[model samples]
Target: MVIDSLLVLGGLALLVLGGELLLRGAVGLARLLGLSPLLIGLTVVAFATSMPELVVTVAAGLEGRPIIGVGNVIGSNIANILLIVGAAAMIQVMHPPRGLAKRDGAVMTAATLAMIVLAFAGTLFWPHGLVFLLLLGAYLVGSYVVERRSGTTEPAGEAAEALEAAPQTWLPAVGLVLGGSVGLVIGSELLIEGAVSIAKSVGVSDAVIGLTLVAFGTSLPELATAVVAALRRHADVAIGNIIGSNIFNVLGILGVLALVTPFEFTSELLVFDIWVMLAATALLMAILASGRAIGRGTALAFLAIYGIFIFVQFDTGFATAVQSAVGL
Candidate 1:
C-alpha cells in the first residue's frame, strides 16, 4: 500500500515536471515556426497543460477501464473550475480579461453544454469522438480568426511570459518536448497502475479513484500554473487556464479516448457527477458574467461546494440519500 502511495506521488511529480517541460519545448517550437503568440497560447500551451489528463485517460481506455477514462475527464473539469479557480481566487481576487470573458467563456459554456447533451447518448463511439475532435478543430480555427480580426495579439499574460522564457535553441527544445512526452507516458502508466491497485485494495470503484485521487493528481500542473498566475495578479491568465483546460478535458482528452475505445456511461456519473460538473461550470460563467472579481467570500463558497462533492464521492450512502431527498 505504501509502495503504491509512493508511486502515485512520484507519478504526480513527474507529470507536473513533464508538463512544464513540454510546454516550454512546444512554445519554443511554435515560435520557431512563426506561430503567433495568441494562436500558440490557445493551442500549444493549453494542450500542454492538459497532457497529464490526456495521457491518463488514454491509458485507462487502452486498459479497458473506460469508466476511469470518462471519470477522469469529468472529474478534472470539475476540479479545474471548483478547486483550481476557487483556490486561485482566494489567493487574490480574480478579474478575468474582458475578451476572454466574452469569447473563451462563451466557448467553454457551449462545450460544457455539448458534453451534457452527449452524455445522454449513453455511450460515446468513434463517430461521436470524431465529432468532438472536429468541433475542437473548428473552435481553434475560429478563435484564431477572431483574434486576428480583432488584432488581439497579446496572449494570456503570465502563461505567455513563461513560454516566451523557454530555451530558444531548436535542438534542446526538441529534446525537451520528446523527453517530456516520454516522461508523461511513463508517469501515466505508473499512476494508472497505482490507482487501480489502490482501488481494488480498498474495494472502491475505479470511477471513485479516478474522480478523486487520479483527477487531483493529473490536475497538479494546472493548479500550480493558476496559483502562480494569481499571485502575479494575472487573474485573467489563471481563469483562462481553468476554462481552457476544462474545454480541452472534454473535447480533446475524451474525444481521443473515445476514438480508441468507446465508453459507456456509468449510472452514477450520469445521475450525479455530470450534473455537478455542469453546475460548477455554470457557477463560473455566472461569476464571469457578473463583471465582478471572484472575491475571497465567493472563493470560500466554491471550496465548500467542492468539499461536499468529494465527500459525496466517498460516501455513496450520503449521495444516495441526498439524491432521494432531492427526488433525483
Candidate 2:
C-alpha cells in the first residue's frame, strides 16, 4: 500500500514538472514562429497543459480500462472549474476577458451539455468521436476567424508571462518539448498503474478511482497554472486556462480516446456526475457574465462544493443511498 501511494505521488510530481516544461517549450517555439500569444494560449498552451489528461485517457483506453478514460475526462472537467478555478480565485480575484465570457464560455457549456447527451446514448463509438473532433476543428477555425475580424492579435496574458520566462533559443526549447513529452508519457503510465493497483487494494471501482485519484492527479498542471497566474495578477490567463482545458478534456481527449476504443457510460455518471459537471459549468458562466471578478467568497463556496463532491465519490454508502433515492 505504501509503495503504491509513493508511486502515485511520484507520478503526480513528474506530471507537474513535465507539464511545465512542455508548456514553456511549446510557447517559446510558437513565439519564434511569430504566432500571436492569444492563439498560443488557446491552442498550444491549452493543449500542452492538458497533456496529462490526454496521455492518461489514451493509456486507459489502450489498456481496456475505458471507464478510467471516460471518468477521468468527466472528473477532470469538473475539477477544472471547481477546484482549479476556486483555488486560483482565492489567491486573487479572477476577472476573465469579456470575449471569453461570451464566446469560449458558451462553447464550454455547450460541450458539457453535448457530453451529457452523448452519455445517455449508452456508448461512445467511433462516429461519435469523429463528430466531437470535427466540432473541435470547427471551434478552432471559428475562433481564429473571429479574432482576426476583431483585430485581437495580442497574446493571452498568461502566454505573454510564460514567453517572458521561456528559454530564448530554439535548440533548448525543442529539447524541453521533447523531453517533457517523454516524461509525461512515463509519468502517466506510472500513475495509471499505481492507481489501478490502489483501487483494487482499496476495493473501489475503476470509475471511482478515475473520478477521484486519477482525475485530481492529472489536473495538477492546471491547478499550478491557474494559481500562478492569479498570483501574478493575470486573471485572464487563469480563467482562460480553465475554460480552454475543460473544452480540450471533453472534445479533444475523450473524442480521440473514443476513436481508438469505444467506451460505455456508467449509469452513476449519467445520473449524477454529468449533471453536476453541467451545473458547475453553468454556475461559472453566470459568474463570468456578472462582469465581476470571482471573489474570495465565491471561491470558498466552490471549494466547499468540490469537497462534497470528492466525499460523495468516496463514500459508497452515501452514493448508493442517493442513487436509490434518484432511481438511478
Candidate 3:
C-alpha cells in the first residue's frame, strides 16, 4: 500500500515537472515559428496546459468510466477558477488586462455556457464534439489573424538570433521538446492512475475524485504557471493562463473526449457541478470587468468562495457516509 502511494506521488511529481518542461520547449518552438506571445498563450500554451485533462478524460472514457471523463471536465473548469486563479491571486494580486476584460472575458463566458448546454444534451457524440472543435479552431484562427492584422511583433527573430549567436545546435532544442512531451504523457498517466486508486480507497465515487483530486491535479500546471507569472507581474500571462485554461477545459478536453469516446452526460453533473463551473466562470468575468484588476480583496473573496464550495462538497460527502453507516 505504501509502495503504491509512493508511486502515485512520484508519478504526480513527474507529470507536473514534465508538463512545465514540455510547455517551455513548445512555447519556445512556437515563438521560433513566428507566433506572437499572445497567440502562443491562447493556442499553444493553452493546449499544452489542457493536455493532462485530455489524457485523463480520454483514458477514463476508453476504460468505460464515463463519470471520470465528465467529472474531470466539469471539475477541471471549477478548479481553474477556484483553485488555480485563487491561488495565483493569493500569491500576488492578479489584475486582468484590458483585452482580457473586453474580449477574452466574453469568450470565456460563452465557452462556459456552451459546456453547460452541451452537458444537457446527454451525450458528447461526434456531431456535438465536432461543433466544439470547430469553435476552438475558429477561435485560434481568429486570434492568429488578429495578431497578424494588428502588426504584432514576433519574438521568433530574437529567439533565432539568440540561438545563432549561442554555441548551440538544433539537436538540443529538439531533445528538449521531445523530452518534455514524454514527461507530460508519463506524468499524466501515473497521476490519473493514482487518483483513481486514491478515490477507490477513500470510498468516493469517480465523479467526486474527478471533482476534487483529478481536477486539481490537472490544474497544477496552471497554478504554477499563473502564480509564477503573477510574482513576475505579468498580468496578461497570469490571467490569460487561467482564462485560457478554463476555455480549453471545456472546448479542448471535452471536445476531444467526445470525439474519441462519447460520454453519457450525467444529470447530476448538470444539477450540481455545471452550475458551480458557470458560477466560477462568472466570478472571473465579474472580477475582470469591475473596472479594476483583481486585487487582494478580490483574491480573498475568491479564496473564500472556494472554501465554501469545498465545504459544501464535503458536507454532501459526509452526509452520504453517515447514511451508508446507518444503512439509510
Candidate 2 residues 1-328, lDDT tens each?
8989888888888888888889899988988888877687667876787888898899889999989988898889889899988898888887777767788999999898898888887788999899999999888878878887988777666666677877778998999899889888888888888999999998777988888899999998778777877778775577877887888889999899989998988777777788888899999999889887788899999999999999988897977876797686
Candidate 1 regions with alpha-carbon error over 4 angstroms: 99-101, 319-328
RMSD of each: 2.2, 1.9, 4.2
lDDT of 3: 0.70
Instruction: Indicate whether candidate 1 or candidate 3 has the larger TM-score.
Output: 1
Pick by TM-score: 2 or 3, better one: 2
Ranking by TM-score: 1, 2, 3
Name the weakest run of 10 consecutive residues (lDDT summed) in model 1. 319-328
Flag clash pairs in model 2.
37-155, 38-155, 38-156
Per-residue lDDT of model 1, residues 220-282, tens digit only: 888887788778877657887788788888888888988999888776787788899989988
In model 2, the worst 10-residue window by lDDT is 154-163
Error of 2 at 277 (Å): 0.3
Please give the lDDT score at residue 193 for candidate 3.
73
Per-candidate TM equals 0.95, 0.94, 0.85
Which portions of model 3 miss their true places by more than 4 Å? Answer: 31-39, 154-169, 316-328
Pairs that collide in candidate 1 are none
Stretches off by above 4 angstroms in model 2 are: 322-328
